[model samples]
Target chain A: MSWSFSIGSISGIRIRIHLTFALFFIWIGAAFWNEGGMAAMANGLAYILLLFLCVVLHEFGHILTARRFGSQTLDVVLLPIGGVARMKCIPEKPGQELAVALAGPGVNLVIAAVLFILLGSQTIMQDVAQPAKNVSLLSQLAVANIALAVFNLVPAFPMDGGRALRACLSYRMDRAAATKLATRIGHILAFGFGLFGFVSGYPLLMLVALFVFMGASAENNSTQLHQLARRLRVSDAMITQFSTLPVTSRIADAVALLIHSTQHDIPIVDGVGKPIGLLTRARLLRALHDLGADGQVADVMRTDVPTVSDRAELEDALRLMDEENFPAVMVADQRGHLIGMVTLENLDQMLLLARLQPRE
Target chain B: MSWSFSIGSISGIRIRIHLTFALFFIWIGAAFWNEGGMAAMANGLAYILLLFLCVVLHEFGHILTARRFGSQTLDVVLLPIGGVARMKCIPEKPGQELAVALAGPGVNLVIAAVLFILLGSQTIMQDVAQPAKNVSLLSQLAVANIALAVFNLVPAFPMDGGRALRACLSYRMDRAAATKLATRIGHILAFGFGLFGFVSGYPLLMLVALFVFMGASAENNSTQLHQLARRLRVSDAMITQFSTLPVTSRIADAVALLIHSTQHDIPIVDGVGKPIGLLTRARLLRALHDLGADGQVADVMRTDVPTVSDRAELEDALRLMDEENFPAVMVADQRGHLIGMVTLENLDQMLLLARLQPRE
Candidate 1:
């Protein structure tokens, strides 16, 4: 996502391309230029471009299916390996996920079938074993689409088949347990691929194996984190002993508090003991730079600081913090009095601890 | 980052490889085996592996420099195109960014120089023009490293040289302005590369041109967004008109409220008019699914719902919501009474409006 640039928006979704994907085009062009000159370069580029177009459509299948389940697709990025449709979040419901995963390969299957019908099945089959350079574009594309569908159907993590497998398994067990079992199977399959690649001296298969191995564990970890988040409460993670300031305090007071204590975000309370503002370290630093340390805390404190009740779900709390882009959230009691705070720094600590602690 | 798995941690930074990178090795292995057999395959693989090691070191150069500037390197992912060091954020200061950008190419220059010296200047120079297969490993690597350094130094968005150029430009102008100018120049350069690639029948260069062209505008858009965020406040964008429910209300009442009103988050207030909890549509739906409509709003409402001051910076509010991972943040007045709310849905609409509105 970092190195990606959007080429355009399609059907309300941004279509992005990673900088590296250019290398595939370049490499193929250079290879063809050296082998068969300008005409060959044109032919090769066109064929590959067509193939990439198919990849886009394949990704669109997944995107459309995901949209049906109410998931938003943020961007569709083309990498050298394949196109990745990044959704805001995947459907947690197994049936929805299963449909989304299958949709991609199904598109490819449809493309292959259509091409087969157009080009004649026997000719397409005969040309399937031939290299792209030696075969007709239609026949080559038909075979490539079939290969794409079959390759993606491999029961490996991060692949469509792996997700479908997990979805099916989830119907019979806990989501987390299903994920763990599916990931394990993915790893085993990856190991097989790696063994075969190494034995056959095919680095490509080994690379795929490595990808599968990594993807399986990564998905497992993410799902577990999500599960953990769902079970947590803001009260379980909020910091209760943090320092606070009255609205009448000067900026100098906040600077003094910073020196004497570890607190960076000091809540400002009203006469009624309600938190009226948050004096963040960044704001304090900027106020000091522009208005001097003698500036009133009231002038520097952010009045629109995000707050949460102690009983808020940790996931919801995290979601709020993420949405507001705030560094900390003040925790309030049922009386609407500030009781504690939740900061990203402390949330990370809580996550680390959660990882170490056993699941309930 | 979602699909990424850490192969290992080095110096507290995770090192990862994309699944497709293994394709490079596979390609080389197959190509070499077909050309010269096992010995050639071994030689080719070793050379390429060592080349990739140099790329890793190149990325480390950027990482170490960025770390010095207080930017955390989240992970280093190797793709077949090159290694990318994904930092939490680039340095805000121009000078620091310049140094970080140059550090990567500097590493490659050092590697090239060292290898050039080790292989002897004359021999290395002679072999530089030869194909990779015909040259000694050290000689080829020396040339390759030099090529890497030079290639990376070409001013292109998301590339090290382009960043350095922008950093230099930023010294004389606003960061957002500098980024826009730099991006425009990058697009021009990309156009040149594309034209040249087409003329020479080199699709690779065309691909690189496309990447550069897109990357420039993407970076420009992101920087502009950050700049816009710095200038706005939550009060400017929050939803002021929202319905509220008394804590004494039942879940059935909230359900009826939802059917008639567009508001999704129904804030629940206490007897004294202080906001106590939030009955989000999601929470209400889940409650209805499990507990039936007879549940009281007081029992179903999320007391930990995040709230924000009406006067906070929009960026800070966004950051808080993001960190808390909440969809919305309640806006409270100085009296600790909920007056408005900020939802991601509305925030996106505001962003779209901001994009269309001219800046001061």
Candidate 2:
């Protein structure tokens, strides 16, 4: 996000520009100007920008279809290689995934067809085959689209082609199994691309290969996490037995506990035992350093907390934790009272257990 | 990690090879065989393998220096691009960082020096210039080493050159300010490189630009988080007045609470007001689906919890949570009691507040 900025939006989805993506245009302009003066630079910039627009349209094709299946794409980011649609959640159904995956390349194919008609196939082919002369902008655009379509259809992980393959395989096996197979295929394809690029000294192909390879691995891990989420519950991994502090205690009291107790975070409660705030060990030292140990517990304790019922699923808890980027959540009972806590460690244990004994 | 396998270990640092990295050789062998026959194939593979070994050695130059400064490196992974040392915690001291940053390039420089002496400058240049034929493997190696050193010295994020620049800048300004300046310079440099790559049609330069740009942003965020961790405590953001559940509660009771309470995770406590376990919201629904609402809370709640003293630093708590991979951790007071909770949501508010009021 730091390297990208919002360009605009399509409906609710924001279209963003990666900083380097914009730089690519400026780079093209500067380099072309150095080589062939202003006219060539202008032509080059125009050509690059048009190609980018086509890539954006291709991403939209995927984004729009995904939206129909309740997948919300937050951003469409433009990079040199292609446009990436950042969808936080993808539809799980294989049928829907197949449609979503195919939509992008499908758009490119249509664009190529339309451009070919507009430019005339004979003239377009003539322009496409030549690099120095008789090249129409239309033909170049058509060729770019066609290349995008063909390249995307190579069938590998991290690509539309790979997703389509996974979707098809999912019909015969489980989603995870299908994804694993697809990811392997993607790796092989990426290796092929990278090897070809290295020997031929083509950086573009090498970068593509890296992306495909990394994507395959990352996708597999994400799918595995999803499966774990579905099969587990918060109760399966919540931690019990921790220390607490009274609301009347001062920073000195908390510090004393920090030295004596292994606990680095203490929950503070009122006289009647209703929770009021939490004081972490770091806060304790910080307070001692800044406010002195005399600082009242009420003044230093954190009071903004969220509690969850202990009967919840680990999946929802994991989602909540991810969104919060926090390590722990408190658990509550039917009477709306704090009873336990769930930490990232607990979740890891549960995940490990589930992985080891999936049927359990 | 799924796409990488450990070949062995040096001291404690594991040497891992990315799957594609190994496949690159196979790809070279097959591609070369098709294009130039056995002699060419053998020569090509030998050249690539030797280059990768240099890269690995360059990485060792970094890892050894970092280890001396107490930064633990778990893996040194080889890829076609280069070698990556996965250092968990980088040394923060400006001098240490500078040393760690320069070591890899320094090693490359040394290798170049030694190779120059071995191959003789005249022969090396001839071999490096005409890579297609009349190439001495030794001369090719010297050129590769020199190129590596030169490329890595380009001041940018995600690269050692940028780190070195930042380290130098840190002496004149605050660490945060220095990083910001360095990042901007890195971005501009990345843009320049990318432009040059595009114009000259060099894919390697373009990928390096992308890595630099992204690394700058990621590094800045990480540094800011570290700063925040030092200045803030769990108390600054711990949520208070949250709901809790009693140990005696049943799944049906939790169901009642779930419908009425906004809390998703419920902490369960004993009669004397001591925490026993935590149940998450997802677990509530899952338990209902799997075990019915009549199931006992004692049987389903998570009990393996870790507690921290309320006086502990938020940084420590954050580390604990990260290691635990949990959503929440219980806060304990002097009496070893769970008085409050800190959830990921609370941490977010704290982080947001800290960012807004850095001085505070």
Candidate 3:
């Protein structure tokens, strides 16, 4: 996922081209070029490009639909295998998810239909069916669209059809259970594809098989983790006994406190016993190295940290922390009173416990 | 990274084989089977499998060396293109990093050397070179090892050579700047490979080109972000003031706190003024839905959350939180006294500011 590049943005959704896609085009061009001339090579290249454009549009269909369901699209990256639309969050509602999943292949279907109608009206059915050695660009594009629609319709995880199946099943069972079922179906499909590709001598089909298998497994794991996070709450995993420091404290006093206490983070509180900021060891070291022991705590305290209530959803809080790239959060009470602090270490301990616990 | 399956652990490092690697074998078998018969298919399959084994050994070389430098390897995943060893952390010391990176290609060199020596002693070089159009397994394996070593030495990120280059440069320049330099060189190599592949009609070369391009770009981005994180601290981005609830508080009290204070998590403190646990809104709702208003706050509170010292490193804190899967971490002072809480929202704000801040 990290090893990709964004080409541009279309309708606010970023479009990325995977590095391997270029190899696909190059191979296609070379394999066909020797049989004809520059025209044949160009034609093959054009067809591959057109196919990928359709793939991009298909991904966009999912992106736009997900957007409507209150989810944000991170980006759509094109790989040699296919395009992937990274949705920030999939909707919990079965209907919304189903609609989003269907939107992709639906766009491809429309493209194929339009092409079919055009070819039919022009009496070019024969040319469309058995494309000539040097096929026309329009006919090639049409055929590619049709192929795209058909291929994507195969039930496989990371494929539109598979997603649709999962969404539908989620309506009957819990999302996690539905995902598990979908993964099972995906594995079966992967085996089928692998067997078919080996028998048919189509290497691309093998790639599809691999994609489906991996995607299904990833989806299952992510869904399970999310379910666990949803069932838990922030308070269920926070550390309570911590330390604090007043803003008026001197560097010498902070140092003395650090020497006597096990805490590393010193929360700077105001005269009214309200936390105003925090002073970390890194900051203290810099201050000590630059201004010596006489410097005030307020001079090095940071005030841009996030705070949370003691009762927020654990999953939501974790997600927020991950997205914001923060290390810790401050907790408060009903009267805006500083109570305790939480950090990444406390979260890890909880996760470790959860992992060690016997499953129900 | 997330699209692979772990096979088992080897020398304390997880071994994962991507589904695509299986596809690679299937494709080789199919291509050869069509060209000849079952024997030819078996020959091709054996060659590919042996080649991948060499790839695994190459990755193990990196892993073993990295271990010596106090870096833990998370896993080694085989892809269609090659193998990837995901290390827990890269050594900052230039010498150690350089040694670890060079270890990979060193394994390939040894394999090739061993094969050459065996062939020479057995006087089977000629027979190995021509095995009636099926190709000898030993000969093919030797050639593949040599090829792997050379290809990986082409200086590209996500590759052994590129890391070696970065390590060497890091000694003289900042890590981020060295990464940028190496990435530039990698891009140049990628373009060169693409051009060569286009003219020479080699699909594999084209694939390598794409891999280099994407890998370099990713390395550049990751290094840039890491540099930023290293320069910042937790105190620079934690939130101070927040709402909470007492340990004796009732469900109705929590609901009122949620409504009036907009606080979603409340820390429950005992008579000794120590935080005993946390009462989150999700738990409160579940308690109310299951046990009614008579449920005590202590009965629904969570006791296994993470806590952070006010002076902890921001990057370390974030990493711990991510690993632990904690929603929020409590911040404490020198006396193990509860100060405040830090959550994801505060971290996001800090990142936004860091990103938007004007450079001198």
Candidate 4:
């Protein structure tokens, strides 16, 4: 996010180029200049730009298909390796995942087919043997599209082919088991590809191998986390008991309360038991440290505490809590009365349990 | 962790190899086999294995230094890129961090020095210009050590030089400001290195560039989180109010309670207000679905719920909660009475707030 800047927007999704990608352009230009001259440099850069264009189209295939399946596309980032369309939706139902997975390569296949029709097989084959020579750009691009489709279909985890495999497997097994099987298969393929890449002295192929291996493991963890989220609700993970301060209470009382109770951000209520403000631990400490302890709780407590309904999904509640600024979100019942609170520390426990006691 | 397994341990720290790394060896071996037959294959494998040994020793430098500062190392992992010594203890105090940072490269410095002495500088100089020639192993190793030392001192984020820079800067300013400045420097260096790597055709340098750029952002985020943790206590992050189900409650009552309240993991209390067990939302739902709603709360509840003191640190409580399998941890007073509960959803709010409102 820091090194990348937005280049443009496509149907509401921002297209950003990472600094590495930009610098890569400069490097490619320099390399081409040394190889031939300005004309060659221009030619090489054009080829690369058009190639990345194809990559973008491939990414759109995944993006549009995922959107159709009801997942929101946040951003479209173009990198040296490929493009990424990040979304947090969990429509991993076997059928939906299979569709989304095949979409990217499906686009590449379509491009290859269109190019073959235009170029004719004999013309494209001429450049296929030695692409670096003064060959037609269209032919190279057509071959590259074919390569992209074939490469992506190699059943590597996190790749379209791997996802397709998992989806197919999920029809007969649980998602987790399906993922485990697909990931194992990915690992084996990664090993073979890496060996071939290393021996052949092609770093990009090795990079692909690394992606497959790492992607397999990362996807494995994510799948497990999603499985955990599927069964849990917000109330299941929110605390039911805590202490609060009163408007008439002093900073001294808040400090004492902090020292004695687990409630770091104490809700300040009036005589009728309505929260007038929230005194966060950081503010309380800063207040005590900066001034005397005699300040009224009403004068120091934060008044903008957000609230969520008790029956909200754990996933939704987490999203709300993450999007809001309050240290804790007040949990309220149907009557809109504050029944409890949720904090980051509380949810961290679930993460711990998820890691330690991984469900089969 | 999923793809990696322990190879061994050093001074209680487990040494693990990621699956990618293991597969990388296979790739290298195959590549060398095709390059120049069996002898060349053996030579290639030996060089790679020894090079990674240096990487491991370099990691040990950080692990040992960190331990000296009272930090614990959970594992020493051998990655394809390098090695990672994972530890959570924060001793980001300027002087201490500088020492830990330098200790790693310092190990390489010593290795190079000792190897130079053993191989003789004049003899090592012959292989320096072309390391792939039929040269003595000792001479090549000496040069490799020098390269290791120099590369690591590049002032890249998460690298020793970058951390040393932050430590030095921290002497004059707060850590957050120092990290921000150092991270910027790392970004610039990464760009320059990436450009050079791309033009000069060295993939390893490009990898280092990626490391610096990604490391800068990650370290920046981590530093901010630490700053947040440093100012807050457990009481600050804990939730303070909610409802609990009594042992006499039935599954029907739990269903009703779950529908009405935000508390998901309901504490089952006895007549004296002591928490005898905890009824997690998942279990309650599963019970109501499998059996009839007439099942008693006491008949189907987990009795292994853990407890924490009210005045504990947020960091410590989170760690404890993560280590235990309980859906929620009971917050108790000095007299050992269950005064409150901490759930996973509760702590999620703090993480959200931290990401939203970054403090300087």
Candidate 5:
């Protein structure tokens, strides 16, 4: 997402190109320039662009399927490695996941089929073995599409086939277990790919191996976190011993509370003891430097502290804290009087404790 | 962050490598394999690895400086394009930001200086111009570090120089205004890079251009949102009218309420009129199919419905709802009795209205 610019938007989904992707073209142009001059540069550019066009189509295959199942596509980013379609959420249903996973390679298969038909299958086969300079563009494209399909089907966390494999496995077990199984398989494949790349002096295979290995582990970690989150309530984790300050308190008082208490953020309450603002350590320090320690806490405190019901789910509270980039959330009772607080540090501690607890 | 594996950690900072970065070596190996076989491949690998070593040092430069200012570095990820140090938050002070920004290129400058002394500046330049097969690894790395320094110094968002530029500007102007000015300069530079790349048949420049363009716009968008958020309150944006369901209500009853009202989520209250849970339309529909319409609303309602105080800032409440992925946040008065709700739709409407409002 960083360093990527939207080239256009289609059906509400932005199509973005990463900055480094341009390097691919430059490298190709420079490589070809010495071998065959301007014509080769033009040819290389066209080929790479066409390849990315197919890649974009392949991502669309996944996007359209996800949209059909009610998951929104946030954006499709074209990286130097390949295109990635970021869905709002992956569908939980095995059937829906299977369909979405298969859709990408299916599009590639279709493209390959059409290219083979138009260019003739025999010519495509010859082109696959021959060097790029000698091959016809149509034949080269046919082979490239087939390669894309095969490459994507290599059972990895980020690969289409990896999701398809997980979907199948989930039908028999839990989603988390399925993800673990698929990730293991992906890692094994990645190791093999890396080994082969090293032995055969092929760097491309090695790069893919690294991506697969990381993707597998990352996916497993996320799934594990999701599993832990599935069984928590706000009451189980909220910090009940945090100190609160009155809205009338001075910045000096907040500074003292910050230094004397372990709390980095203190709630500022109104006359009826309802939280009106939050005096975060960062804000207090800033106020101390700029507005002086004599400034009123009400003037320096953040009034936009998102409050959550004490009875709410811990997972929801965690999500809120994470999303708002809030240091902490005020937990209130039904009448909205602050009863507790949920800080990121405490939430993390809760997660660690939960993981350590043996489950039935 | 999503697809990177930790190689190791140093002083609590995790060093990660994206799987795709392995491709850099593979690419170099293949390019040189034709020129000089295994020897060239070995030389290429050694050169690339050394270059990345320098990149790692460059990132550490930023990480160490940030740590000095008390900003935590989440991790440093090595991408095919370059290394990215994900800090918890950018320093608010102009001086701190400037130091953090300059530190990266400062590391490269030191590396380049040391390399020049060791390899000799004349030798480094000759090695850089020579083809891969003939270049010595040490000489190549010396020149590479110099190139890295120069390339990063190009003023652009996500680039160290751009941050330094922003820090300088913010000293004289407001942060938001300074960011706007820096981003404009970044965009202009990006446009120039893109045009030059297209004319010179260099794809690498184009990619850098794309990154700069997007980073500038993204930074601008975030600043605008932060500004808008600073001006609103929860009560100013909350929905006052909403349907509620008693805990005794059945799924069928909830379905009826959902169909009759615009509310997609209804608060389920206890006998004493305190909210006990939320019956979301999606949950109700899922329950209807699985548990039958006769199921009690309490059986399917989410107990973890995040709540916010009516007096909280609208931006904070909006952030909480967005983070929790809650359709609506239950708004309660000081006694914690539900008085209203804050839906994302209403939050957006409020933001839009706020933007259109005339400044004081």
Candidate 6:
């Protein structure tokens, strides 16, 4: 996801274009030029641009609908093959998710309909159906839009059709089970696509097959994790005992603590017993390398540590830790008093226990 | 990455094969069978299988070389495009990284060389140039190996050529900076490949172009994070303030806590001052729906939770959170005494600071 750069935000959701998409455009242009000179090259470039615009609009449709259900839209990234609308979180409610999933194909359908109406009004329907060797831009775009809509509705994972299938099945079963079923169907579709592609001499179909197969597997894995997280809590996984150091403690004292104790990080607390900063072995080493071990702990302690309420859901906590790339979180009371620390070692132990225990 | 199922550990790393690879086999079998009957199909299938075996050997070369330098291999997942050997961490030393990356291509080179030498005296050598159209299995495999070696040497991120480029530049610049430079070059190369692909009528070239562009961008982003993590500490980004509840509290008490406090989860502690479990709002609501508000909180609390040590590296901690899908990590001392909690909110604040602060 981080492999792309955001071009801008629409209605609070960012829009990004993968670098590969730019290459795809360039290829189309070059191929056109080589096949039929500058005029054809320009026409092909225009068509690709128009298609990508439609792709962007289709993603926005999903983003807007997700917003309607109170879920945040993170971004829409355009890949060489298609677009992906990254939601901050999928709607837990089956209906809401279904609506959001359908919105994307809805946009494509609307585009295709509009194009059809315009072509019909101009009496160019025949020309559009059997596109000429050198067709007009408007007609080409219309045909491409229709093609996009139909292709995306092929009931494959990483496509709108697969999401629609999952959402519909989720109405009857748990999300995990629904995803598993959808993934199985996706694999079947991938195999079918690959076979069709080879027989028809269409290489693009092979790419689609690859995408669907990988996408379905990824979806299943993530769904499994969500199910696992649902069965666990924060307390059962948090670390309770940790070393604490006073803000006034000397760097020498912190160094001594590191040498004698198992702890590699020491929380620095003020006189009121409130955590003010964190003193880690790495920071201490850096300080010693520059300012010497005689320096005060306050001079080297990091003050931007993240904290969490002792009473918060483990799922939310894990999400936060992942987003922020934090190693540990300090637990505190409502009065902002530092209570304890939670870390990865504790989380792993919790997971091991959960896996070993029988499901209730 | 999700294209395959891991088989087992090899020198502490998992090995997997993409589903599309099976499709590749089936297609080869069917194509040859249709062209010239069972014997021809068997020959084609054998050739394709032999080519993939070369690919596997190439990947193993990279894995074994990395292990020699004390680097850990996480898993090797075979993609339709190629195999990806995930390392626990890339070697920081320029020499080690260069050696590990070149190992894959080196293996291919050896195979190609050996094939050419053996076939040089055989009658098959006369038709090696057009082996794809010919029915000779050994000849086709020999040609394929040569192509694989040459194609993989093209400068592209996540490829041997790109990594080699980065390693060379890293000696003079920072690793992140080297990655940025290499990625930019990769983008240019991707464009070139795309253009040539279009003009040459080779559709597979388009896929190679897309892979290069995306891979380069991913490498850049990963390098940036690695650099940032090296400079930061776990404690500097942990959360410290939180809420808690007694283990004996009722579901009604949880409801009251939710209504009166902003906290959405409560860690339940026993009389011995140890955390017994956690009760999340979602779970509490589910319990209330199933067992009524009169139910005891102990019956609804999740006892399996994730935790972290206050001293763990920030990056490692974040990876654990992602792997376990935990919302928060409880920090504890070496003796398992409750200390504090870290959450996503606090980590975000630290990230904001990191972005706002000027790099040295």
Query: What are the per-model DockQ values?
Result: 0.02, 0.06, 0.05, 0.09, 0.02, 0.06
How many clashes (backbone N, Cα, C below 3 Å) per candidate? Answer: 40, 87, 62, 26, 13, 64
Residue range with the least summed lDDT across 10 consecutive positions in model 2 chain B: B351-360
Worst 10 residues of 3 chain A by lDDT: A351-360
Considering only chain B, report the TM-score of each candidate against the true chain B.
0.74, 0.76, 0.71, 0.74, 0.73, 0.72
Give the poorly placed runs of model 5, Cα more than 4 Å off. A194-207, A240-306, A318-330, A340-349, B1-360
lDDT of 4 by residue, B202-297 (tens): 666777789779989877865665566556776666656557778999887776565444457778888777778889877876676556577798
Residue A16, candidate 2: C-alpha displacement in angstroms: 1.9
Off by over 4 Å in 3: A1-131, A134-360, B1-49, B67-80, B86-89, B121-133, B184-226, B239-306, B315-330, B338-360
Q: lDDT for every model?
A: 0.79, 0.76, 0.72, 0.76, 0.77, 0.71
lDDT, candidate 5, residue A99?
A: 95
Model 1 sits at an interface RMSD, in angstroms, of 19.4
Question: Lowest summed-lDDT stretch of 10 residues in model 6 chain B?
Answer: B351-360
lDDT of each residue in B1-360, candidate 3, tens digit only: 366778788767788878877766677887899988898898778777788889899998988888888887777888888888877777878899889888888999899899889877344457555654755678667777888888888677657888889999999999888988999988998889866764564556667788889988876765665566576655554544455567887766665444333245677777655666777656766776666655688889888766677788767666665445555666667776667665554454343333433241
Q: What is the lDDT of residue A75 in candidate 3?
A: 80
The best candidate by lDDT is 1
Top candidate (TM-score): 4
Model 5 lDDT tens row, A282-302: 687677666775789888888
At residue A178, what lDDT does model 1 achieve? 92
Model 1 off-target regions past 4 Å? A187-215, A241-306, A319-330, A334-360, B1-360
Q: Positional deviation of B9 in candidate 5, in angstroms?
A: 26
